[model samples]
Target: METREKILKAAAEMIADDVTATISVRAVAARAGVSTGSLRFHFPTQRALQDEVLRRIYQHFMPNDPLRDRSLPARDRLVNCLRQMLAPAGVGEDARRAFKAAFAAFIAPDPSEQVHTAYLSYERASAGRITHWLNALDDEGAVPQRDRAKDVRFLLTVLNGLAMERALPYGDSVLQSETDTLYTAVDAILGTAAS
Candidate 1:
């Protein structure tokens, strides 16, 4: 990768470690083995670097898959979509640490609104994917006569709620239960159309 891209990637990796941590440009430059001035030339501010990293994360989380094609059954498509969203893509200790650090930062006191906004953006991106899947299901006669958009919204809301719950304290058992319930509900929804 180019020097600028390398710098951004290093900064992203660092920020991912602790999304809310006030990371220094010098640290990023040191990580990237570039001059601090070079890092600043690429990303003038910490926020700019963070916004780019977040954007990249969002894009990776929400891929443009060909599952939307009508050739696949809606049930399969919906399941695939959900799997993509729920699957943990970040790997190894470093990435996990980054996620946890960033997560805690977002939940920390003072100027918390930005973290909330980032969360909403992530939720909406996932929701949009869900909406696409549901609409496809409707087209394939997989979702009965229900309002596809409403169903999509409800499903996304439930999914997001479950994800958040899983991230919280005292949610381990509840998270598993909620996942089971979510699958059962999904199965019922698809099964209803066949009945």
Candidate 2:
């Protein structure tokens, strides 16, 4: 493989293995079997390298994401897209395990700078993806031109709460409640809330 591709691959592998998603330049260079200078030649800064890796990761995972489906109503599409984020949590024992892993990685104790930075990077990427979806809806005139930042925050807050609920004993109505909450949030953000 070429030098640039090799470096990127090594970095991506490191991120995949790391619970905090931390990427160290020297570590990547060592893994790629290249010198730091060579790695620097392709990616001038750490942030640039991280951004490129995240962009590629998102593209690979979301190539045919539901958010791109124009056939569905805007609200439905948005709600479905949000639901996809929670699908990995499953339910019952699965959800509990997922929550346990997350807590151990991010919430059990004080997080290091690397852990904190990695968390922030992921958070920013998620917010960026949500904003992109909102922008697409706005372009289609399906959503109002409001403060999209606030809307993104609102949706993320709801998603976080719903994810936590999945791990708890919510009884048989959990799925229906989640769906209703998503639809209501989508409606509010799109300015189509029922009277």
Candidate 3:
């Protein structure tokens, strides 16, 4: 790989392993086997490097915007896409860790309003896919498509809540039970039987 790509890849891997580290330019340069000046040539500031890495991390999780598969059945595709988000393995543990650290940073003493804005932007990007899937299914006479936004919001809310719960203390069984509940609820809402 090229030096810039190598530096990014190395920093991404290290950040995934430990997001609390200094993650300095020299450290990334050493990891990329390039000079510090070379690394700085690509990223003039720490924030720039981190922001690029963060974008890369999210892209890795939902590449090619899998959520935009309007050709697929909405309910089924939404469920499948959501399942990927719930599990920590699909997105790479390191990227997940990096995101978590970034989230923590956002919620620290001096939070960024831009981060909140970014959350909505990212949500809309992913949620658009789910919403489109549902609308397409409705158009095909599969679903009634009433309150499509509400349906998508509810489903996403439940899915995200369950995933967060699963990641918290003393919530394994809660997570599993909620997952079962979600499957049942979604199946009924979509007018389908469990496969």
> For residue 30, what is the lDDT in candidate 1?
96
- Residue 99 in model 3: lDDT: 51
Give the best candidate by lDDT: 2
lDDT of 3 by residue, 9-65 (tens): 989888676644546898999989999899999999885786577666656765754
Candidate 2 vs candidate 3, lDDT winner: 2
Clashing pairs in 1: 16-98, 17-98, 19-102
Ranking by lDDT: 2, 3, 1
Candidate 3 Cα errors over 4 Å, as ranges: 1-77, 88-99, 109-111, 170-178, 191-195
Compared with the true structure, what per-residue lDDT tens digits does model 1 show for residues 30-52? 99999988888888986566556
Which is better, 1 or 2, measured by lDDT? Answer: 2
Kindly give the number of clashing pairs for every candidate: 3, 0, 0
Worst 10 residues of 1 by lDDT: 89-98
TM-score of 3: 0.48
> After superposing candidate 2, which stretches have Cα over 4 Å from the reference?
1-60
What tens digits encode model 2's per-residue C-alpha lDDT throughout 1-195?
A: 999999889988986776355677888899999999998999988856765676566678789778678887888899998998888888878989988988887788698986787678768767766776776677689998888889999999998888889999878999999999999999999977544
